[model samples]
Target: MHLSDHDLRQFDDAYLQTLTSAQARALLGKALADLKAARERLGQNPSNSSRPPSTRLPWEGVGGQETPAGEPEVPAVSGDVAAVADTPGAAAEPEETADPRPRRQGSRRPLSGAPPGRRPGTPGHSRTQHLPVDAEQSHRPTCCAGCGQALTDAHASRAHNARYEIELIQPGVGATGLLLHQTKHTYYECACDCGHWTQAQPGRAQAEVEWTVALTEWHLAGPLLVAFICALSQRMRLSRARVREFLSDWLGLELSTATINQCLHEAGRAVAPVVEAELYAAVRNVELRYADETSWKEHGRLRWLWVFTCATATLFVVGKRSVEVVRQVLGETFNGWLMSDGFWAYRDLDQRLRCLAHLIRKAQALEDGLEPAAQRFGIEILTVIATVMAAVYDARGAPPPAGALRARHAPMLNALLNECLRQRDAPHEKTRALARELLNDWDTFWVVLDHPELPLTNNEAERALRHWVIARRIGMGTRTAQGTRAFAHLASVIETCRKRAVSPWPYLAEVVRQRRQGLQAPPLPSPAS
Candidate 1:
C-alpha cells in the first residue's frame, strides 16, 4: 500500500503515542519546550530571517573611472557669464556672484529690547521674565504696633519674644495669595570668658513624605494593568514578549517577561484574604444572590471562575468547575435562595431559584415544529409566567401581592410543569432526555416567582464574569494558581466598587494607603452616594 505524506505523518504520530507513558510525556514536554523557544526567538527577530541581500554596482573603466551603463561621456560645465556679457542689454542686468562661503541659514537677528547679551530665540530670551525678590525686602512687614512705637531690632527684645511669623505670597490665577506660617524659636545666649555668643537649637527634621511601596503596588496592579494585559493579550493578540515591549514603551517602566508574571502572581496573593472574606459575606446575604461559572485557564490548565454577586457586593472564586468547589465556597448548608442556571452541581443546594430565562429559551426550542396544541400550550404558559414577573418588577417599591400573583399564574405554571414531567418520562431522543433531566428541577425553577427580590436569572454573576472572560482571551490564562486567586480578588473588589457606584482606582488607592497607615477600612459609600 502506498501512503501520502499526511498519512505517513499520521502513522508516525500513532507509533509515537504507543510508547511507554513516561516516554510519551517526556517527548511531549520536549516538543512543547522547543515550540516555546521557537516562538520566543521569532518574537525577538521577526524580520531577520526574511530580509533579502543587497546588490552593489560594479565600476570598471580604461582610466580607472566608473563607466556608465550604455555609454560614457565627458562632464561639462557652462561658463554662462561670458554668454550673458556678449548678449544685448547684458550690462543693464543686475550683477550676480557666488561667494561659496558657508552661509548660515535659519539664523535670526536679535530683536530690540532683548535681554542683555542674549540671542533671539535663545532659551529664556523671550516672554515675561521673573525677577528674584530679596528675602529681607519681601518678608519685612510695613507695620508697627508694639506700644504704638516704630518696631525695630533694638525695640523688640529677642529675649522676651514669644514667636516669629513668616508669610509667603505665592502667585495664583490672577494675583498673589498669602500663605501664613509660624516659626517658633527660643533665643539663648551664653556669656563666654572672652566674648558673648548666641545659639538656637533646631527642631527635629520631619521625614520626607511620598507614596509607600504598598500604594505604588496598588496603582500598578489596578485597572491600568488589567486594561493593558487585556488589550495586549486579548485585543491585540500579541505574544508575551511583544506585550512586554509595548507596555515598557508606553508606561515608561522596565518589566521583564518573568517580572510581569511575578507581579500578577503577587497581586493575586495580596487580594486573596479580602476576596475570601467578601465571598463569604456575599454568600451569607439572606436576600437572593446570583451565581454563575465560566471557563478560565491557569498555567494552561483548565479551570473555572465562579462569580457570586448580590445587589451590594460581587465575589469571584477561581478553581476547578465542580460541585465540590461550589459547596466549598458557598457552603453546603446555604439555605437562602441560590439563583443559578440549570447546572447539575447546583442541584444539591436547597431553595435553588433556577433561571427561568434559560427555561423559556429551552421551551421555545421545544415548541418549534411541534403540534399546534402543544406549541400553543407552551407559548401560553411562558407568556403568563413572564407577564407575572414583569408586573412584579414594574411595581418597584410596592411589589404585587405574592399570594394574588401566584394564584393568577399557578394554573399555567402547573400545566407547564406537568408537560415537562411528561416529556422527561418519554423523551424523543438522548438530547431530549438530558433536557428532561434539567426539567426535573422544575420546583426550584419557579421559586423566584414567590419572592419578588430573588432575581429570575444569574445575569448579575454572568455580567461580573465578563471581564474575566475577556482577560482570559487576552492574557490566555494565569500562569499559576496564586495568580488566578489574585485575579479573582482584584476583579471582585473592582466589580464591587463598580456595583456600589464608586470609582475603583481611587478606592483601591485609598484602601492600600489607609491599610498601610494602620487606619481602619473606610465604609464604602452607598450606591447613591
Candidate 2:
C-alpha cells in the first residue's frame, strides 16, 4: 500500500479516529505484513539474495550454515531443545550444527582407524636429477674453539664436509633461456697449536620466522631461487603446481611443488619485517591514506584482506574484517586524513573522508528500486553530490576560503537533509536505509566541499588490492595462517615497490639473500621525484 508523506506521518490517534473499526484493523494488518517483509529483507545474504559477498556475516557459512538450493532450511536444534520443541507450543532453541550434506567426494569421515596425511602406498616424489657444480668455495675455520689461538688454511685438516647449493642466474646479455647455477661449499676443520679442531658451519638467522621452513644459509636452493619462486607465486600469480611445471619445461629444473611453496613462504617471511618497520610506518606518517578490504580465504575458512595505501607506500593485511584490524593498521592515534568507504569501523576516526562514489552507487541502486518516492529522492541526492563535486573541481586551481563551498551549497544541502529526515521511516526499506545513512554521517559527505584537496573516492586502496584479488581468484587464497601472513607482506612490498617506480624482483632477491645470511634486508628505494 503506497501512502503519502502526510499519511505516513499522521498515523496518530487523531488520524485513526477518522477511520472505521474495520478500516483501522486492515491498516494494522498491512503494517505488520510490511514489518515482516522488512525484517526478511534484512536477513538476506550473499547465498540467498542479490547482496554482495562483503555483506555476508562471519557465522553465515560456518556451523548450521545455509543449506543448498531446493532444500528447506532446518534450524539447528540440540537434543535437549529438540525434545522440548516436540511438546505443544514449546519453542526450540536454535544451536550450531554440522552441515549434514557432504561438500565434496570423501568429505565425510574416512573409514575408522585410517591414518592422516598421504594414504598408504601413494606414489612419492623427490629430487632425482643431480645438478653439476659450476663453482667451488671453501669455508675454513679462522680460529681454534678450544682457545683464542688463531689458525689459517695452512693448518686445515684434509677431511672436509661439502654441500651443494642450486640458484637461478639471470640470463646474460643476449641470452634467451632460463639458466641454473650450482655452487659447492666445502667446510674444512682447522688444527690449532693446542690440538683443538674447529670447523665453520652455515649461518642461521638470529631472527626467527614462523613458517614450515627456517631461513638459513644451509638451504639447497639459494636466495635468487627463493626470490624467483616468490615472483612466480606472488607477482606472476602462478600456483605452486604451475610454477613447478614452468620451471621443469623452461629451465629443466625438476623442483617439487613443496620446494617452490617453501621458497615463496620463506621470501614472504623475510620481507615481513620490512613492511612492518618501513612501509607501514610510512603509511602512518603520510598526510592522506586510503583503506579498503575484500574477502579472502585461509585454509578454506573465510577471512578478510585489508589494504592501506598512500602515494609513497602500500601495506596489506589479512585477518578479520573488524574495527580492531583497522586500528591495527592505522592505529588509534593516526591523525592523517583517511579516505575510505562507509564501513562502521572507520566511523570513529577524527579525520576521515567518506567515499562519495560508494554513496552515489547506493543512490543509483535506490533510483532503480521499485519505490517512486525513493527514485525521486535518489535523483535529488545525486544532483546535490554532483553539484558539490563540481564546486570542488572549479576551485582546484585556486581553492576558496574554508567553508566557502559548504556555505554556497547550504540551501541545497539543507533541503536534501530535510527530505531525508522526513523519509527516515518511509514505507520503502531502501529509502529508509539511505535516509538513516545520510543522517548518521552527514558531516563526512560535505567535508570535501571545504577542503578541495581531499579525494572523493577510495580508488587508490582499491587499485592496490586489484592484483591480489585476481591472484586470490586464481589460487583460491592461502592455506594457512603463515601462508596468509606471507601473502600479505609480500603483496605489500611488491605494491609499494611499484608505487616507488622500482623493480621489486631484484630487491626481493637481495632481501632474501641478506635475511638468509642473518643480516638486515636493504631498504626499499625512495619514490621517484
Candidate 3:
C-alpha cells in the first residue's frame, strides 16, 4: 500500500515541521481512516493475515473475521488496536490468488492397478546373481521326477548322456547367532615330496579388524569394513546383537555380539577428530545454522547430544549442557545467522533468529487451558504475528527490501510485546512463564520481522536431532565415552551426507579405510566440493 500525496508530504522528515495545524489534522484523520479500513479487512482469511485459520477462536463463523454469522459483534483487541468485527452483511474476503499447481481432490487412495493376490511374475532379485556362492554342488538327474529312480553316482559306467541341474544358495535372515563356517580349500601335498605352495584367499585386509566392544582398529575389507557401515547405522540401527545378526546373514560369518560393540566404539575413535575438525570448520563458515540439544545416554548416565546444522553440513556432539559445549561446537566468533530456541547458550550469538514457532505453541497452549485474559492475550499476540506473516506470505516470502516491514509493522509488534511484557509479571505460573519468555526474547523474536525471508523457527536443528532420537529409542544410547563419540561422528556424517545427497556408506568406508591405514578420516560429504 502506498501513502497518499498529503500523507507523503507530511511524512517527509524535515517537511513535517512546516505543516499547518489544520492541514496536519486533515492528513492525520485521513490516515486513521485508511488504517482502520486496513485493520477491518485484516483476518479475512489466512491468505491476508498471519493468523492461521485454526486459531480463529470461539469468535469466528463462515466468512467471518472475529464474530459468528449472527452473533453480536465484539471489539477485537490486539493491544491498543480495536478492530470492530466485520459486520455479518459486510462482505470481506482475501483477494483470490492464481496458483499454477493443480489442485488435488478427495482423499488419496492407492493406485488401483495390480490385484491384491500374489503376482504372477517371479519375486524381485530371484534371477540376479549379485554375489558368488563360495561352494557349488551339482547333480545329474539325481532322481527321476516320474519314476523316483536314483541316478547313478555321476557317470555310472559312462552313460552317453545325462540331465544336469543347478541351483544357488545364499545367506538370508535366519536364527540369531547362527554361525556359518567359511568355505575353505583343502591343499593337497605332493606324493613325490616336491616343494609346491598354493593357497586360496577370499579377500585381503590391510589391517586386523575385529568385532570388539570398543573399536581398537578399523579393518578395511570384508566384515571389518562393513562393520563401520553397521556401527554408523548406514544400513540399520546399531545394536550389538543386530550387528552380529547382520554380519552372519550378509557375510555368512558368525560373530560374537561383543565384537560388534567393539567395532562400533572403534568407528567413533577412528573418525571423531576428523569429524570434529570439519564440523567446527563448517559451522564457522556457514551462511545459516541451527543449534539444538537432546537427551542422550552415555553408559546410562544422561548426557546432551548437540547438533549444529546448516544447509550443507550437520555437526553433532555429545557432551554436557553448558556454555563450554556451545563454545566447543560453535567457538567464540561465528559470522552466520543462528536460529535456535531461547536457550541461554545460544544467546551469545550476535546474529540470531529466535524461533517464533515455539512462542506460537505456547500461545496455542495458553488458548487451550489458560484463564480468559491470558487466552485472549495469546490470541491477540498471535493476531499481530499473523498480520506480519500474512503480509510476507503475500509477497511470496521474499525478504522485504530494507526497513520496509519494520517501518510498517514494528509498532503493532511492539504493542503485542507490551501486552506480553505486562503478563510476564502476572500471578499465574504458566501465564507468567509464557509472558516472561516473550519479554526476555523480545528483540530476538522481532528480528524475523526485519528479514521476512528468515525462518521464524528452529525446526532445522530440531529435525536434525530426530535421527539420534530414533536411534536412541532403538539402542537405548551408547555405553562408553568412545561409543558416544562414535555415535556423534556417525550421526554428523550421516546427516551431512543426507544434506549433500551423498550416501553415508561409501564415505564411511573411506573413513574406516583411511583411519585404519593411519590416515586422516575422509572429510564430511559435500556434493559441490
Q: Per-residue lDDT of 419-459 in model 3, one digit per residue for the tens?
A: 87788788545578878877777778877666677777788
How many collisions per candidate?
3, 0, 10
Residue 390's lDDT within candidate 2 is 90
Q: Is candidate 1 or candidate 2 better by TM-score?
A: 2
Ordered from best to worst lDDT, the candidate numbers read 2, 3, 1
Residue-level lDDT tens digits of model 1 in 1-529? 1234564466466698689999778766656545544443322211122111111123433222345768765433344766776789987976656554444454333334435675776676232322232232112211233233233343223342232322222356987543322233344333233332333222221222321113222122332343344335433556568768876576433446664554444333434446666557666765678888878888778888888888878888788878988788777568677788777898887777876666564445334423354455446546755775785686555777756657767787777666666656542342245347556686776665567666776667767777667667667777765556656766777777788887665454444434433444444546755
Per-residue accuracy of model 2 over 291-386 as CA lDDT, tens digit each: 988999998899999999999999998999899998888877888799987789999898888888777767776665545687899899899999
The alpha-carbon lDDT assigned to residue 175 of candidate 1 equals 77
- TM-score, candidate number 3: 0.59
Stretches off by above 4 angstroms in model 1 are 1-243, 332-335, 368-381, 390-402, 434-439, 510-528
Q: What is the lDDT of residue 426 in candidate 1?
A: 48
Least accurate stretch of 10 residues (summed lDDT) in model 3?
A: 189-198
Clashing pairs in 1: 233-474, 234-474, 268-486
Candidate 3 Cα errors over 4 Å, as ranges = 1-235, 249-251, 395-400
Report, for every candidate in turn, its global Cα lDDT versus the true structure. 0.55, 0.82, 0.62
Which lDDT value does model 1 have at 506?
49
Output the TM-score of candidate 2.
0.79
lDDT for predicted candidate 3 compared with the true structure:
0.62
